[model samples]
Target: MDIHGRQLQSAKQHQVFVNFRGDELRFGFVSHLVEALQRHQINVFIDKLERIGEDLTNLFVRIEESTIALVIFSRRYTESRWCLDELVKINQLTDQGLLKVIPIFFKVEPVTVKQLRGAFGDQFRDREWEYRCDKPRTERWRDALASVSCKIGLTFEKKSNESEFVKIIVKEVKKMVQPQENYVVVPFPGIRRRRDTSSHGRQCQEEQVVLSRESAVLVQENSKIANQIAVVSMRYMDIESENSVIRAQLGELSERLQSLNSIIEVVEGVVGKVPEIPEFLMNPWQIMSTSSQPITASADMFYYP
Candidate 1:
């Protein structure tokens, strides 16, 4: 299901996916940028909800269908095999004209990112030796890096203060995610007339018209089915979203109930020892002590009389 209340039968929209290793700063920045994109009504997909180690193939599958791949360049990013493979795949896709690769340098120098040099250079050299390849892959990586640098200006920021960095990236992403007119589908010429035309040469014209009407009806039925599928998908999405909200609220209510239970327990413990009595009434012992002797003397005097 998609935001448009459709079944997402095809991947036609511009999808941006963020690719980054477990660099906390990079994740934070990218996450903030994703929120910004959502605010701007841009559909953004993240690689994973949790960190998966060195599974380049899986990560590639996750982002393969995306239209835009946003790569976060950091110093430690070069050391990860998965990150390297993702970069290679991005380059391959670019060569195949399948995707647009955008590089955002996070606390890494532009020259380092472009040249694939310094720490990146050392890592690539080590890998190349291990593979014992006839052709070095560094050139491809360098070309990809350079291409991205030229196409989109490198955004550099300190790793400590990533909020500001996220804001900057969000601004850039918003510019890239501007809404454009949808592609118009042109129908074949004389399609309606062809259907309307008689088939007197081959068969009865009435039969041809009947067949065409049946075909049109079938097409309409198929269209209705597709629309129904889309509507059901959208309803499921709404239900899932509502479920998430309900779960969050349930968690909050559970916490509040626990707090209230604790307070009730404390109040019960405090009041349990007190005797039950009316505050305005006197004790029975006080009334007996005050009136008993006078009542016995009055009864004896009346008997003597």
Candidate 2:
């Protein structure tokens, strides 16, 4: 089956499957019951009015998928052959433990349905010959009726509040329904136990697991190394910025040295403008103690005289 078919086949799809007779119950009581069940958020599948004209094959399929079968044994239930077939199916599934049957004797006494007397008997009596040659089928239907009526179930009084009656049935169904699950479980093929694994296969799986862990560690280490490289690059950029500042400072210092050279040249030109001192005056102390000073002074006095 495809995914949709499998989903429809799940018992969880419809937790409560309702089976009832003709328009008398479906329009009157069953509608209220379905509404109450829906109000309580119960997933239910009920036969539509037009279901009488259409094919009922899918209805049985829905019945099979449901976990609970709610049989409404009204006055006209035994009159419908379709209803009898549904009841039989419900009984079979109940016997197999796949479905739970909750019978509601709607305005019909449990004794009436069980003994096939009163309203239930009159309805079946009219159609008795339809199943005379098929006694086994009629017997199946009777057995289904007996089994369902014997079960502990609720009864709707003729003049009582039907809303409250439906409430009781809804409560009972809710009590029996499993919790609704959001996810569907897809079936898997069967497998052997762990003990069936060969030693070599086990060793290979272990080695693969180790390799997976090592790969994760390697990825983490690579991330750390990349972060370190980024930090180093930022520091390098900062050092380059510092080197540019130093270069600018050096250029300013060179300009200041050139300005100092210009000031020294200006001072030397000012000194050159003043009178030149004789080399003998520069060595005056030594010149006074030598004979050169006296000879120079005698020549000077001779010239002046």
Candidate topping lDDT? 2
Give the per-residue lDDT of model 1 (tens digit) for 1-305: 23432322144354777767666544466667778778777777775643767554656655556677788877767666566667777766654445666788777776665555578657755765665663455444434445554445556756456667666766777655554233211233444323223355335445545676677567546644543554355346548879999999999999999999888788779987446575334465566656657644666676854
Q: What does candidate 2's lDDT look like per residue over 1-305, in tens digits?
A: 35654554464567899999966787788888888999999989887723567788677777888889999998888889889989888877765556788888889887777666666787885566687888888867766776667667888879889888888898899878755343222222352223215788667557655765676457546644543554355346548879999999999999999999888778779886546789889998877677744543455666754
- Give me the runs in candidate 2 sitting further than 4 Å from their true place: 1-12, 49-53, 178-305
Clashes of each: 0, 0
lDDT (C-alpha, whole model) for all candidates: 0.61, 0.75
The per-residue C-alpha lDDT of model 2 at residue 132 equals 84
| Candidate 2 lDDT score relative to the true structure | 0.75
For model 1 the local lDDT of residue 116 reads: 51
